[model samples]
Target chain A: MFDSKQFEKDAAEIMARYDQKKAATLPLLHLVQEKIGYIPPEGEQWVSEKVGVAIVHIREVVSFYTMFRTKAIGKHHIQVCTNLPCVLRGAEQVMAYLKERLGIDAGQTTPDGKFTLSSVECLCACEIAPMCQVNDRYIGPLDRAAVDKLLQDCV
Target chain B: MASEMVLSKRLKNPGGAWFDAYVADGGYAAAKKVLTAMTPAQVIDEINKANLRGLGGAGFPTGKKWSFIPKDSPKPKYLVVNADEGEPGTFKDRYLLERDPHALIEGMLIAAYSIGCHKAYVYIRGEYIEPYRRFVRAIEEARKKGWIGEAVQGKWDWEVTVHRGAGAYICGEETALLSSLEGGKGFPRLKPPFPAISGLFASPTIVNNVETLCCVPPIIRNGAEWFAKIGTPKQGGTRLFSLSGHVEKPGLYEAPVSVTLRQLIEQQGGGVRGGKKLKAVVPGGISAKILTAAEIDVAMDFDSLTAAGTMAGSAGVIVMDESTCMVKALLTAAKFFAHESCGQCSPCREGPGRLYKIIQRVAAGQGRRQDLDVLLAVAGNMEGKTICVFADAAAWPIQSYIRKFRSEFEHHVETGTCELGHAYAHH
Candidate 1:
C-alpha cells in the first residue's frame, strides 16, 4: 500500500541538501510521517534504505525525538504547554477545561477520532502564556470563552 | 526608558523583512563591506572590539568563539546557527526570525567570510512553524537578490541550509545540535574535541546564537566603538529581553545591558500585573537563580548578575508578583528539566527525575520533613558530575527556590497544603 516510487522523488531532494546521505534521516522520516500521518514499520524501513542507516537505527532515531509518532493521532492534535510561564498563567485550568469538555485526559484520542490532547513542555511562546498548539497554529492566553470557540472551530 | 535599539531597530517598523524594504534600510551593506574591504582577521578584531557575547544563555564571547576555527584546516569549515530557542521563559529569537530574518542572513554572510565557512546550517525548532516559514521565505528572497547561494554579493561563495529540529530542548546545546544535525539523537558529545577543532563531520565548526548573529550586522555597519558604546563596557549593544509572567505588559523590550532588572519590570513591563507588590523575579530563564524584589536593583548584564550570584541567562526576565507561589513555580521548572533531560549522563538522567518526584510529593500535600534536605543533597550531587551543565541547571531551581523561600516549602511540608492558597484553583 506504501508508495515507494512517489516517496523517492521527495526523499532525493532532502538527501541532496546534506553532504552525507545519513544526515537526511530526520528529514526523510519527517517527510514519510507528513505523508502517512505516522512512522509505520514500512515507512521506517523505507527511510532506513533512503538514508543508508539500518532500520533498527532509524527506529532509534524515531523514538528519541518526541515529535515523531509511531501511531496515527486524531484529526486535530492539541498540545497544551504546561511549562512554568504557562502554568503561572493558569495552563492547568485550560487543560482541565479541555479534559472535561472532551472526556479524555492528556495523551488520549477522542472516540470519534476527531481530536487528540497532549500536555507538552515549552513551545517557546511564553509571551502568549497559557497557550496550546492545535496542529500548526498557536492559540494563546486561553480562557473559558476561548476554549469553547476552539472546540467549535475544530470542525 | 528606551535605550539604543541595535538589534530591534528594524523590528520597530513592521514589514521590514521585505527584500526591497530591507535593502532600502541598508541591509547586506555590512556583508558587502566585510567581503570587499575587510580581511577575515580584521572582521574578527572588529567583533572583539565590539565586545558582543552570545545571547543564548552562556554569554560566551562571540569573536573569541569564531577565532577558534583553524584557518589552515584542510577540511571545510561550517557555521551552524542555534535557533533552537526553547528556554522556558524565553521567546525573543522567534521575533528576530519572523520579523527581520535578513539581519541573520547578513550576519551569517559576514560570519562565513570571517571564518572561511562556505556552508552554513540553521537549526530551527520544529515547534516554531511560523518563524521557520518566515525565515525560509527571507532566505529565498536573498537567494533571488544575490545575497545568498553560490556567489554572495557576487564576491564570496557561501551556501545556507536551514535544518529543523524534531523536538528536543537538549539540541540547543552546540554539541547536541551537531549530533542532531548529523541525523542522530540529541545527545551532547564530550568537549575538548570542541566543535572548532572537530565538528559537523570532523571539520571545524562555529555555532552562534540567533540573537548573537543578529547583532553582527549592526556591529559591522557602525564601527565597533559605536556598537560597544550602546551598553556596559564588558558587553556591547542592547538585548531584546523577553519579559513575561505576572507582568501587566508581557512582551519583548530592547534595553542596554546596563539596565537594571527593576527598570525592565517597572518601566518596560508596566510593573507587576494588577499593581500587586513584587515578590521574586527570575532574572533570566528558569535555570538562573531566582532574585527577590530587593535584589533586582543590580544590573541585568552577564558580569553583574554573576557577581550577584545568578546569571543573565537568555535575558528572559520572568516577573513574579506577591500572589505567586514559589513551591508551585519550582515544581513546574523541575518538571521541564525532568521531561527534557536527554538521559546521557547518569547524574542528569537520574537527578531531575528524583527532584521532580520529591517536589511532586510536596506539592500534592504528602511531603515528609526530610524532603528538603534530601532535595538539596540530591541537587548538590547532580552538579559538576554531568558531561553537560544540564544537571547543574536542573539543580539551580531546587537549590535557589528552597534557599530563598525555605519557609514556604517548610509550611507546605508541615501543614500538607499551601499557605498562600491553591495556585491552580484561583488562577
Candidate 2:
C-alpha cells in the first residue's frame, strides 16, 4: 500500500547515514509511519527487505517503542505525561479531566475518531509539569481551561 | 553559599540558540584551540585534571572514559553524545539543547578531537522536537562558519549527526542507546564488550552525556584546575539539577556538585509548595532511593548520595510533600519501570511487572501481611542480576520505598483503604 520507489529512495539516504544497514531499522520504520500514518504489515516487510534484516526483527522494533503505532489513531493524539513528576504535579487530575471531558478512558479514541487520549511516561518536560503532548506539540500544566481550549482548536 | 550557574551561563541570552550569539560569547574558541593547538593526549589530560563526570546519571569520570578508547584500533572511533534525557525529573539536557545548542556542538567537537573521532552522533530523545530542531540548526550554523565538517577551520575534519530515538526509556542506557542507534529495539548489550571496547558498528566508541560534553569546552578554555576548583575535591564543575514536584519553584537549577539537597530544595527550589512540610525526596532520578525529609541535608554529589544509601543518578531531585502517599508514589515509579523494562532479560522483564502488580494490589487496599516481604524478596532478586543495571534501578525504588515507609504500607494493608486516597483511583 506504500509507494515503493519513494520508500526505497528515502531508505537509501537513511541507510547511508549509518555504517550498517541494521542501524537504519528504527529510522526506516519512522519514515514509513510518517508517510503511511501507521506501520502496516506490508510496510514492516518493506523495511525488513530494505534494511536486509528479518521481518520479525523489524516487528520487534516496531512493537518495542511506544511511538510506533500499529493501528490507526485519531486526528489528534493526546499523550498526557502520567509518570511520577507529572503525577506529583496533579497529572492525575489533569488525566481525570481529559477522560471525563472526552468521555473516553486512557488509550481509547473518541467515537468520532477526533481524539485518542493515552497516559504516557515522562516526556522529560517536568519544568512545565502536568503536561500533555497533542501530536507534535506539547501543552502543559493543563487545566480545564487549557484542555478546553485545546479541544476547541482540535474540533 | 550561592549556587553558581556555570553550564547555564548563556541560558538566559535572548538569542542563545543562534550561532552568531554563541560565537560572540566565545563558543567555538575551545573547539578551535583543541583542534589546532592541543594534542589528543593533552586534551584528555586537561579533562582528566578537570574531574568532570557524566551528567546523564552514572557520574563516571569524563576524561577517564575518553582515555578508555583504544588508540591503536583500526576501526573508526566514534563519539556518541547521549542526549536521550529520559530519566524522570531530569530536564537539564533539554535546557542545554534548546538554549545553548552551540555549547553541546562545541563540546562534541572537543570530545571527538580528544578521542581522534571524525564522526559523532547526538542521540536525542524523540519527544524533544524543539531541542532536536535547535541542535540541527546549530550544526548547520557551525558547518557554515567553518567550525565543523570537512577539515573544520582548516585544522581537522569532524562531523556530527543528530539521531532521534523512538520512545523508550531503556535507550537512556549507553549500550541500549548504541543498540537503538543501530536501529534495533532499545535492548542493552552485555558489557566487557562495553561501548569503549566494541561499540557502534563494532568500533571503539566513547559515549558521553550531553551535559558532560558541555563541560568540556569550558574546561579546555579555563584549564582543568579552574574547572576542578568549581565544586568538591573529586567531583568538579556545576551540575544541572532538575527540581520538580512539591517545590514552590519547579524548574532546572545549575548548581555545584557540593550543593546539598537542602540547598537545592530550600534555596533554589523555594522550599516545598504551599508551605507544606517535605515528606520525601528522590535525591536523583526515580531510580535512586527515596530520601526522607530529614535525610535531605546531605550533599547532592555522587559519593555523598551513595554514602546516604542512594545515588545522585541523573540529578533529577523529585521532591514529595507530606500530603503525598508513599504507596501511590511507589506505584507510579513501579509502573514507569514496568512499562520500560525492554523485556530482553528475564529478571528485568518479569520483576518490574510483578512489583507493579503487587504494588497496584496494595494501593487498591487489598494486601496480605506477607506481601511486603514478598515485594522485598522480588526486588532483591532483580538487583545485580541482569544484562544491564535497569533491573537494579527498577529494584531500588521498590526496596527503598518499602524500607523507609513500612508504616504507610502497613496502613494500606490494615485499613483496607489508602489514607491519601487513591491517586491511581481512576486507573
Q: Using DockQ as the measure, which candidate wins?
A: 2
Q: Local error of candidate 1 at A31, Å?
A: 0.6
lDDT of 1 by residue, B1-427 (tens): 3447787778877688778888899988898999888999999999999999999989999999999999788999999999999888999999999999999999999999999999999999988989999999999999888888776656788888888999999999999999999999999999989999999998999999999999999899988998899878899988899998999999899999999999999999999999999999998898999999999899998999999999999999888889888989998899989999999999899999999999988988889999999999999999999888889999998999999999999999999989888743311
User: Superposing every Cα of model 2 onto the true structure, what RMSD results?
Assistant: 1.4
Q: Is the docking of candidate 2 incorrect, acceptable, medium or high quality?
A: medium
Clashes of 2: 1
The chain A TM-scores for the candidates, taken one by one, are 0.97, 0.95
* Tens digits of lDDT, candidate 1, A1-155: 67778777888788888988888888888898889899999999998888788899899989999899999999999999998888888899999999999999999999999999999999988888889999989998899899999999998
- DockQ for all models, in order? 0.66, 0.79
Off by over 4 Å in 2: A6-9, B1-3, B422-426
Best-fitting candidate, measured by lDDT? 1
Q: Candidate 2: global Cα-lDDT?
A: 0.89
